[model samples]
Target: MTATTSPRVGDEIGPLEVRATTLEDLVRWAGAIDDYSPIHFDPAAARDRGLPGVVVNGPWKAALLSRLLTDWLGESGTVTGLRCEYRRPDVVGGTVRARGVVSAVTRDGAYECVACEVWIEDGAGERTVVGTATLRTRRPETGGAPPADGHGRAALIGDRLRDALRVGAEAGRFTYRVEAGDLARFVHAVGGRPPAETVGTHVPPEAPPTYYAVLDPVERRELQLEELLDELPFAKTGGGNAFNEVEYERPIRVGDVLTVVTTYEEPYERDGRAGRLLFRVRRNDVFDADGHLVARSRMGHVLAYDLDRVAGR
Candidate 1:
C-alpha cells in the first residue's frame, strides 16, 4: 500500500490576522455568548478586584485558535484534537496575532499533520496563548483503516479531561464586569438584535438568548484556564501541546455578576501499540452574584511523551 504524503513540517501554511482585543470586543464576545460577568464589562468591579482591567474570556481564545486552524485547512480537514495553555490575561484594547507552524507530518498509509499555534503579543512580543492541533487529510477513498485504539482515544479523551480539571480548580473566585456599550457592539457583530432587558427599554425584563455568552457557567472555567496557563511555569517549556473542545450550557443576561469556580476531577493512563498515554479531567461550576448555580463545564486532555527520546538509550 502506498503511504499518503502531506505538507512538510515547518510549512508556513498562511498568516492569520489576530483580531485586536478591545473592551467592545470583550463585551461583544460576552454578549454574543449571553454572558453577564461584571469582570468582562464593569471597570469599577475590575478595579476593585485588582486586575489591570476587564479581561477577555478563555474560550474566546480557543475559538480564535480554532478559527485559525479551520481557515488554514479549509473545510476538508478533520480536526483530530486541540489543546491550549492560556499563558497570560489579554487585556482589552491590545493587538494580538495568531500564528501557526507545521510541526510534523506522519503517514502510515494515511496523511496527518501536527501544527503549533500561539496568540502572540502584537506590540510586546509575548505569547498569551499556546496551542497544538492535529488534523487528518479528508481523503474519502482511504477506507477500512484500523480503528483508533486505546492510545488514540485516550489522547483525545484525556485532553478534554485536563481542560475540565484546570478550569474547575482556578475559575472560582475570579470575577468580571460587563458594560452597556460592550453589549451593543457584540449584538451587532453576531447579527443579534438588542433585547428589552439589554437596552433597558419597554420590553419584558428577560435576557436575550445570545447574552448568556457572558454569564454562562462554562465561561468561568474558560477564564480560569487562561489564568492558570498565564501562571504555569511549564508554559515556557516551548514544545508541549495544547487543545480544546467547548460546549455552552445556557443563556446569560446583562447586569448580572458571575462567579466561577473550578475543580480537578481525575486522571487516567493507558497503554497502546504506539506507546503509553495519560489523560486528565476537570470540572467547573458557575454562579451568579445572588449565588445561584448557573452552569457546569467538563474538559479533558491527553499528553503523549516521546518514548524514544525519553529512553536515551
Candidate 2:
C-alpha cells in the first residue's frame, strides 16, 4: 500500500486515482490522438446512434489502463505489451476506475518483469474494459511475425465483401515527430502527470506503451482504430473498436521521429450477443529515426449491420 511496496502476484494496483469523464477530456483526446470520432464529442450524434449519451473514447480507456500499470510500477517501469477489450460503454459524466493485480513476476538478468491483469470498472461495479499487460522495471533496449494470410473464418465472408476486402494491403505510411507536449496532453487527459507546459512538471523522457496509439495522425487519412478498415464500402458506415494489442521494442522518447507503416489483415465475421458482427484487423509497425522497430500494434474493430436492409435496397 506504500510507495516503497514491492508488487507480489496478488498485489492490487490502484483502482487508479481518477475523476469523472467529461466532454473536455474527450475533446482533448480527440485533438491529441486524432480520433475525432463524433460519438466521443457530439451528444447529438451519440443519440442518433441509439446511445444514451456521449461515451468515453475506447483509446482513452486503453491509455488509462496502461496508466494503471505504469503509475503503479513508477517512472522507471515500462509497459512491454498490452491487450485490452472494450467490454462495455462508459458514458461521459460517469466515473470509472482502473485497477489491476500482479499476475506474475520474474527476474531476467537486470530487468524485473511483471505481468498484470487490469480492468476498468464503473460505479455500478461493472467492468467496461478488461485486459492484461506485461511490464518491466529497469529498461533494456531492444522486440512479431505477421498475422497469417487468412486470419479469420473466410468461409463466413460474403463473396462480394470478401473479394472487395483488401487483406494484406498496405494502408499508408507517414512520418510523425514525437513531441513532449503531445505526450503531456495524452497523459494529462488520461489522468496521469501534469501538462508539460506547467512550470514545474518536466517533459517525460519516454512515453508509455499506449503512446503509439495516441500519436497524432496529422498526415494520414485513417485514424488509429480505423486504419485497416478504410476504403471498404461495407465499412464506410461505422463501427467501434473491439480490442487492441500492442508490443513495444523500446520506449518512444521525446524528439524521436517515427516512420509508421500500417497494413490490413484478413477480415472476418462472428456472431455476437447483439447480432452478426464483422471484424477487421489493422497492424501498425513503428520505426525510430534510426529505422529500428519501436512498436507493433494490432487493432480489432467490430462492425454490426443489417443485411436485410441492404438486400431490400
Candidate 3:
C-alpha cells in the first residue's frame, strides 16, 4: 500500500468485501446519480418488462471496478486507463466482491506502470464485470523499460490517430430530451452512498453518473447508423465491445436537452498473441441545449470477423 510496494506479476488486489445492496441502497443510488429506471425500483414494472427483477445498473459495476483499482494502488498511484466489459447483470440486493491480480509491470516514459486483470463477482461467485486496468506507480528495481524519446513516441501515437481520421466525416447526430422520469430511473439505477439525515421528499439537482448511456445516438435507429461501422471494414457481422470510457465536465440536469454527435476515429491493427487484432475507436460528444460541452466518451471495439485474414499479413 506504500508508494513503492512494487507490485509484481500475480499479486492479488482484494476480496474487498462490499455488503449486499438493498432497495434503500438502490433508491439512494438512484437519487444520487439521477437514474430512476423502474426495473431498478418497481418490481412490477420489471416483471412487466420480463426481467428477473429490478436490474442493477451496468455503470455501478464499472464504478466498482474503478474503486477496486484505486484501493489497490493507494494514494501514490494514479489509474491511467481502465477498460470494462459488462458481461452479466447483477441483480439488486446481491452481495458482490471486487477482485484483481497484477498481470504485468513495465515502464512508460517517466512512470512505472502496473497492469491488472480485474473482475467483480456476485454472491454465487459468478463474474459480472471483467476488465483490465493500468496504473502508474513508482519504478521497480528492474523491469521492461519504455523506448527512448518518450515524447516522440507520444507524437507517433498522435500521428497514428490522425492517420485514422476521415477528414470532415461525421456520424449522424441525435438528441435526447431530458425528462424527470428518465432522471428518476437513472438515479435509482446507480444506488450509492445516501445522504445523512435522509429527507422523505425533495428534488435532486443533477443526473446520475452514467445517464449519458441514454444519450448514445447509435441506439436511436440501429440499422441506419450502423453503416458507420461498415466504414471500418469489420470482418464479422458485428464486432464485440472491447472497452468504454466516459469523462464528464459537469452534471446533467433534469431539463437539459442533450445533443450527441458521434465521430468515427482511427482504426488500427496490432499483433496480439492470438493473432492480428483490429481496434476501432469512436468518439461521442454530448452538449447541452445551450451548446455547452458536457461529456465525452471513447468507445473501442475489437473486430474479429476476418481474424484469419489479418493474421500474419
Candidate 4:
C-alpha cells in the first residue's frame, strides 16, 4: 500500500476480540518458549504464588500490541519500534481486544513514519497493556527534508562518544532446544491468544518474534543488550528502546534446537533536537538445529542523556 493508503493520525485499528479457551493454548506457548513458571498454566500454582488465576505473560501482551500496529500498517509498512508496560494480566479463558490509534506522523529521512498510542482492552474495557509505537511507511521518490543534525546544539561529548563506540568488539552466541514448555511460557509471556479450538497435530504455534530475547540470559548477560551505553564514559541520563523489528524466514516449532548469535553494528551518532543521539543497532541471527535461518531481530536503542553535569563546570 502506498503512503496515502496507509493509516494516518487518529486512525483506529479494531476491536479484534481474541480468547484463550483451554490450557492447551497456554501450554503450547509454555512449550514454545521453554517457560514453565506454573503461574501461567497451573491455577493452583498461580494462587500459591499469591496471585489470582493464571497470569498472562507480559511479553505476550507486548507482542499483541505489535500485532495490532503491524496489521494496521499493512504489507507496505513496518512496525519499527514497540514499547509497552504491562499494567495487568488477562487470566485464562478471558477475552480482550487489541486496538491502536495513530497519534502522530513525521518524516524520518526518506520514510514517512507513524507514531501511535496502542493498548489492549478486556471484554469489559479495562486496559491491560499500554504503550506507544513508531511505524514507517514507504515514501515516494520525493523525500522530505534532510535529517536534522542536533538542531545546532553543541556536540558536548563528541570526543567521549568516539572512544566509547568500540567497547564491545565481539558478538555473543547461545543455543537451546525448543521444548514445548518454552514455547508455552513465551506465548503467554507475550499475551498470545491462540484460537480456542486450535489443537491437533498441526504444527505447534510459533513463539512471538521478541520471545527470543529471553531464551538464554546466562550467556547473553555478559554482552548486555544495554551495555553499549555503559561502555560510554558519560553520565547517562536517559535512553531506551527506540524500536524493534523482526523478520521470520520460517516458523520455529517444538523439538527444534536453535542457535542464536548476536552481533552489533558500530554505534552511529545522530544529532537530534534532544542532544547528540548515539543509536546502537543490535542484530540477532536465529538458526534452527539444522542451521537454517529461522528469524532475525533488529533492536535499536538510543543514547540521549543530559550532558550538563559532565559538560558544565
Q: Clash totals for all models, in order?
A: 62, 0, 17, 32
Give the range of the ten consecutive residues with the poorest summed lDDT in model 3: 150-159
lDDT tens digits, residues 1-313, model 2? 2334445799888887456888988987888665667899898999999988999998899999887776666555689999999999999999889999889989878777888999999988799999999987764332122236863422233443434444576666778888877777667667643354454666577987778776424213444333333333342234578888888898889898998887767778876654567886778888988999988888776777554344223
* Higher-lDDT candidate of 1 and 2: 2
List candidate 1 stretches off by more than 4 Å: 1-5, 108-110, 139-313
The lDDT per prediction is: 0.57, 0.73, 0.71, 0.68
Q: TM-score each candidate.
A: 0.42, 0.44, 0.44, 0.44
Query: What are the per-residue Cα lDDT tens digits for candidate 4 across 1-313?
Result: 2334545678886646676534776776666565668899889999998887987777777767777766555555688898888888888788867888889888877778888888888878899988888888876433234246763222323444433333245367788788776576456445554533334424346765566665533223545544334544455556667777788887767777888777676677777766767787777778887789988877678877555555222
lDDT of 2: 0.73
Q: Candidate 1 lDDT (Cα, whole model)?
A: 0.57
- Candidate 4 segments exceeding 4 Å error: 1-4, 140-313
Which of 1 and 2 is ahead in TM-score?
A: 2
Number of the predicted model whose lDDT against the real structure is largest: 2
* Alpha carbon deviation, residue 8, candidate 2 (Å): 1.1
> Measured by TM-score, how close is model 3 to the native structure?
0.44
> Tens digit of lDDT per residue, candidate 1, span 1-313?
1123345677764445555677777776875777767888887887788878877777777787777777666544667788888888777776666777888767645455555544544547677888788877654344243356653322223355466445335634555544555556556445555454446433323444545444434443344333322222221212222333334454455555667565665566575443455444555466777787766655555554444442322
Worst window of 10 by summed lDDT in candidate 2: 138-147
